[model samples]
Target: MKSRQIVLGILKSGPQTGYDITQLFQTSFAFFFDSSAGMVYPALRKLEKDGMVTKEIVPQQGKPDKNVFSITPAGEAEFAEYLHSPVEAESVKSDFLARLMFGEFVDPERIVQIVKDEIQQESEEIEQLQQRLSDYLPSHNRCMSTGQKLAFAYGINSSKTEIAFLKQWLQEHPDGK
Candidate 1:
């Protein structure tokens, strides 16, 4: 999805400063979507230019004025249009998988080490996600949308499945044959 659409979707929840939007991308949307301040600021400018959103400047003491963005009716319509559009297939770009494609040339011990490292990384990711969920749910569960909960579940379960698959593979190939 384009950054513009994502910005619009976030604004739909409520008005937010660009920094707040960036924070959401870094935290809430990090699991499924990748975004940066570079992407968000440009999208905000474009959306404003297109009359899809309005920006309000709030003065802050000893700090730069905050640019809070609110979605316009047009922005809501555009976001809705995007939501109703056909679902695109997910594209995964994994360096590990790419390396595995050339595994025959790599030493077996190296391959085993790579797989072990991946397991460790995925385990860490799952732990962080679970912690975020636990922290989020206590206060936000009533307000959290079903889609948000499903996304959390998907992320956790998929990570767990990856760990299981990797462990099974290691068990089946003790020597990384």
Candidate 2:
């Protein structure tokens, strides 16, 4: 998803400064996507120019003035249009799968370590996603479209299955041999 669209949605909820928006992306949106100030500031500027969103300067003590932005009516309309648009298919480029495909070239020890770490990471994510899904279930926020909801489920299952595969591999190679 485009950074601007994500930022716009956040703004739609309420007004937020650039810093606040970046922090939100880091914490709440971290699971799905991420953005740095480099990308966010530029997008905010572009959104301002495009009249999709508006920014106001607010003075802050011991820091520079903050640019607080919120989505305009035009921005909301544009976002709704994007919602109706077809989603671009995600590209699959897995380095782990590549290593597994050419397993002979990889050291057995490193392969085991990689699989162990990968499985652990995915397992934690799956657990967190399960919690998030439960929390989001009661919310009336129709902002999460069907596509996004579907992807979220896919992400949970994908992580779970990946962990399952890695665990099976570990069982098969008890000594990492």
Candidate 3:
């Protein structure tokens, strides 16, 4: 989804400051979406300019005033329109895969090292997601919707599959052995 639409959907839950939205992306939606602070701030500016969302300057003590954003009626309508639109296929972008594509030119030992590193990285990521799910999911999973649980499962499983593939590829190559 476009950053603007993502912001709008987030706002539907309630008003949130830019920092709050960023944290939400990091904690809640990181499994599926790659939202950065850079993407979010610009999208918020554009949404304000388009009159799709309104911002309130909330005063604070010993700190800067926060810009809290809320979706306008138009924003809700726009988000609904996007929901009704056809879903797009996800485009995969992997630098590791690109490197492996041209592995013939690289040293064989280097390829083995790369595969090992990737397996370690994916393992760490899966651990982090599992920790987050355990920490945040209330009531031992009673509070989580089926789709929310499924998204986490997808991330965990995808990382596991990638690690397994990398390990198997490295074993088959076995040039460093």
Candidate 2: lDDT over CA atoms?
Answer: 0.80
Residues forming the 10-long window of minimal summed lDDT in candidate 2? 135-144
Error of 3 at 115 (Å): 0.8
Supply the global lDDT for candidate 1: 0.89
lDDT string, candidate 3, 1-177, tens digits? 787888998898789999988876887678678777777899899999999999999999999999999999999999999989999899778888898788888898988887888899899999989988887666234587787788899999999998887788777778844
Candidate 2 lDDT score at position 24: 63
lDDT of 1 by residue, 91-165 (tens): 888998988888999899888989999999999988888887777767444567899889989998998999999
Q: lDDT at 45 for candidate 1? A: 95
Distance from true position, residue 155, model 2, in Å? 4.3
What TM-score does model 2 achieve against the real structure? Answer: 0.75
lDDT of each: 0.89, 0.80, 0.86
Stretch of 10 with least lDDT, candidate 3: 136-145
- RMSD in angstroms, all models? 1.5, 3.8, 2.6
Best model number under lDDT: 1
- Number of clashes in every candidate structure? 0, 0, 0
Question: What stretches of model 1 exceed 4 Å from their correct place?
Answer: 137-142
Name the lDDT value of residue 103 in candidate 2. Answer: 72
Full candidate order by lDDT, most accurate first: 1, 3, 2
